[model samples]
Target: MSINNDDITPSKDNEIREPMYGMSINENPKERNPNSSNKLLGVFYGIGMNVNTIIGSGIVTTPGIIWNLVKSPIVVLLLWFVGGIVSMAGSLSYVELGVIHKISGGETKYLQTAYPQPRIMMSYLFSFMHIFAIRPGIISAVLQSAAQYFWYTLKEHQYDDGIDINTNGWKLPFTPFWYVKLLAIAFLLIITAYHMFNTRWAIYINQTLAVIKLITYSIIAIAGIYRLFADWPTSRTNWQNSLNGNSDITAYSASILLITFSYDGWNSLNYSLDEFRKPEKKLIFSNSISVGIVILVYLLINIAFISVVPAEAILDNDKSSYETIAVVFFYKLFGQSPVTVRIFTALVVLSVIGTAATGIWSLFGVHLLSYSLEVIRYRNKGNLKKEKNDKELNEKSDRSSKIEYEVSLFFVGIFILAGLFILIFSFMVHVECPNYNPNCSLREKRIEQMSPMLISYGFLIIALLFYLFYYCLDTLKRQREAKIIRIADK
Candidate 1:
């Protein structure tokens, strides 16, 4: 007997009678589009991105600052440990959110999902802060830090000419002020161009740098361990009274804040979920593993610092003279050799560059602006069905073009603004402190006056007020619509 195709319905158990090639029986074929781009990332890339983002110049700089503030090795280690725990918790939360959404734009998506009553108000606020302040600020800070390291390396060589009198090397002819700003701008352009073209290659380079970062920190930790064993009595003395120091609450609070900032990029992977091949399945593993590795490396590095450098020396090291804690740590370990200084400086510069590059990739990956536009379009169309119609495809193309333009414009604007600020600050410093004295109170005051935190908080306040106003208007509009419907029905 011949059976009609219409009569072939699903069985009571709902078993699949046919499966497509390269697909599991339970998998949905529609989820895997054969015509899409083949540049999707996997679990390892996600881990690399997160690790690169999380381990920036902070790890090399903050430990000494924290130790100076709290004046206790135990408190410094505790703060770092607690910061890691807090960051891990936050990462796990983001993993759950990313899995459910299975999209990019990170906190913007979460805010929109959680608060839909105000009609995109929450997401708008977050996007405003992120695009305007947070993203650019992070990129600028990392690039500037890298420039500072480069300048410090030059300064070290210039002053230690006696040690390297026979060695000939190239050097810049500008002052530190001009040198740093120009170098930072140069780094920004190069990194921007690197990511703008050949995204797959950029990801590979970032992953390689992440691995190098891991190896560098591991070597430092191993050296510290060897030092601890080499002189057990001295190292034991360093840890004997770890808790014997001032307990000023204000300083302790500040140290905690610094540590928390060091752990800022734990949610880096969430920003690129759409790029991942199987985000839902790999999100938890990627985030957990990355955060776990960071936590372990951070603790070990801190222990190593304490083992090699005494707390008194760390606290007493003149901030004006030393570049960073990592500098002091290496100098203590390998002596004041110019070669050792240059080697560690290069490593730190590489770390900063890796961080800035990954940050650029995450921020400019078309996820943020495209997601916003998609949300707006979806609201206007009202649950439209997806079809491969000409008009629909055209609209998608237009949107793609719009997103590309906006992303380019925004990227350029950020760098321009950063450059302007650097120039303005440099001019002011030159005019006010002609001698470039490190102890100039006016320089410190000028920096404090231009604090980004205050500006960010001001934006936050404005956003909150705007949200309340929008919520009230939305509620009233809903009530009016309901009344009109009731009257028509009656």
Candidate 2:
């Protein structure tokens, strides 16, 4: 129970300190570096993280399911707004806790403090680690998606000369697993380099991606709406009919849930609480604007998608919701030449890379934070090298010596562990599908295989355990402190 509770409290029969959590690290986390306040990316950096978290494969995948479930174009656009409100509320709640905690583990950190018990802790631990211990699957999905778009882009390039770009040309070297591993390594390397060398650069990249994503989504949405109006569908319904339309009650309930996930990233800025100049003001601004912007973009994008691709086709064919919709709309309108389809796909892919990179970066922070905690205990009171080193080195080297060791150990461990965790998560997630006909797109397979347990269980379990453990420790600390105060008054 020294000033910092980064680690647990000391185990003693009687100690005159607040019973804290965890133990043993020398480094001052707060003192890592003088944050270079970026004048250019002040607000936009948070926006980037927001967009990055939300716009992953979700955009490409979720919209199709939504299209299938809610066919009305008006409801398709409106659902995004509803999703935004719920997620934004969660973001606001986090901002309040984030200031109180002021650490990077985001909601996970708060849950640990608030819950902190055995059963609850274990469940959350299992799922949390399972999902993002490394993020191999997520990274792979992004890369695989990127490659698809890349292949299509190559087709566009080949079109000017009237040569059919052999889609199979790159297929041999780019096996699914191989491409995933490569993209995982590549994105990790890029993010690591940015964060380690300069965080400002990382934020800058996040912001730039956010801006681009916002603009592209807006344009696509506007374009879609205009096109639909130009040739209004024989079946057009305003908000009243769209909401109460024959769309099944169960379907709308599901759409409500799905759209919520689609706009899941409104609170991305909460994770970067420490890095913010004035997190309090920033959180309000960042979360508010981020949710608003995402909802707007998502609404428009879906409107565009449905306007082009009939709902029935989208429902029947789960593969390629956004892209297929785009192809139908753009090709029929722009002439189904190979070039135009390629161009549209290129934009979608380009837009999502920055989105994917941001997610990798955020998940990386989770490992880094948890690893830092682990390092503190791994060093065991920073006594490892102290046993071997001279009194001179130990004394003059200062309290931070232990911290340096922990930090070093943290990065090394996370890299290895993260990679392995990702592989396992990916495999488990893969199993959600029994037979993968090598012909089926991995994307569709993943959607089919996705387990809702992946998202909800971890948070639920962690919240419970985290509350219990911290409650006992906090209660004991308070009683002990009160006794000490009484003695002093005497």
Candidate 3:
């Protein structure tokens, strides 16, 4: 419970009490939580994680896709409800596993705890997409998306001339050459600094930001809903057939893909397992409550979005279902001046950025914990630790762990910047608006036709394939090995 600075010294007798990073991984993690930052007020922690994990980058973007799939506002809300149920089910499944496993990998971590050795290997391999593909890709996508908004704000405010809106300088420093790079670097630095400072501060800041972001969303939701019934859309049609389609696969797939991102962070409470007050109760409690709140928030937000703007308009997404909807709603009531639109855009952007930051920090913590465990608990025969002096052991472990943390921070930074750069280069994968040209009136495009969405989605498919193939193969191999081991034990 205490810092135990005196016992944390290099003395041989003190070694067993230290954490893995302090040569304590061998010292019994049950007795020491390397990542515990704060006691985490029961409800607030769930709220913190819920706020951190939910309200992700998907919110501003997913409505159109949902509406496209299910054209009715009533159906759209219903679908989100279905999505939340599935999300909660998955979260609850992890609770049993998380309590049993007590490892830090979140989803994969739970799998590893169950299977242990060979199973863990397979889990990580399958998770290469999550680890290598989806997590990084998705996180990068958010930061980059935020970067664009920041770029947009800067462009709008920075330039003396009015916005072209279309031909924005997406560069950092706003110059033609390295403007993108500069902003990318700035984003990385911000992400790295927060994570590096300390987990306690990081989570605290995250929780605080989550609250503000939630409030902002609450207001927007209220305003959007007020406008909806205030002057409910006069025209309506029965497009249920076009929306869900008859195929169950398409319906469910459509539902899963859109909501997965929004519901991705339900496991946030699990990742910091060591930090909780009583993990068993706290974990499930936090997850359930946070997800419940998020469902409410998401449903309200969607209701607000579709309520103010018609399903047909949102489905069209000509100027971004999100922005266009916001623009129309505000214009009807508050008057969508350029400033009003900009501020609204900024709010959504902030929410997304906060989610991205929280997710990346979790990712970093996973690596940091795994590596620290390796360096401390399982000493390599080739490492020549037999000759290590007592006085230097604590110092060396701390130094190495700090380096590992720093290196992880660097890659995380690079990943964010690289993903953003790649998206920008790949024709705005990280940034897209509904093709809202005042000239062209038919706002909607076919699914395959939208370029940015198509590309990002294509990558998503590729990543999923990678996760599926690798994990399946790895799982089979591990299961075979487990059978052999059980036979041997018998």
Question: Best candidate per TM-score, number?
Answer: 1
lDDT of 3 by residue, 288-363 (tens): 7878888898888786766555555544433343432444444445554768767766776677678887878777
Error of 2 at 236 (Å): 4.1
TM-score computed on alpha carbons, candidate 3: 0.63
lDDT (Cα atoms) of all candidates against the true structure:
0.65, 0.54, 0.57
Quick one: how many clashes does candidate 3 have? 12
Give residue 4's lDDT in candidate 1 (0 to 100). 16
Ranking by TM-score: 1, 3, 2
Q: Evaluate residue 62 in candidate 1 and report its C-alpha lDDT on the 0 to 100 scale.
A: 75
Q: What is the TM-score of each predicted model, taking all chains together?
A: 0.69, 0.61, 0.63
Q: For residues 1-490, could you state the per-residue lDDT of candidate 2 as single tens digits?
A: 1123422322122322121223223434344333434432346667656766777556655676665567665667667665665666565565566555545556556666665554236434643553443254455556555655554465442111232122223344544424445654565576557767877687687677666766666667777778778867532433223322245665666666556545555556655555665554556666667777776777667766666555444543324434334445555556647776767666766666776667666665466555554444334432334333234333433542232111133433543453354334443432112243445465654555454445544555665566577658857976887799799999
lDDT of 3: 0.57
Location of the lowest summed lDDT over 10 successive residues in candidate 2: 158-167
* Angstrom error at residue 271, model 3: 0.8
TM-score of candidate 2 versus the correct structure, residues matched by position: 0.61
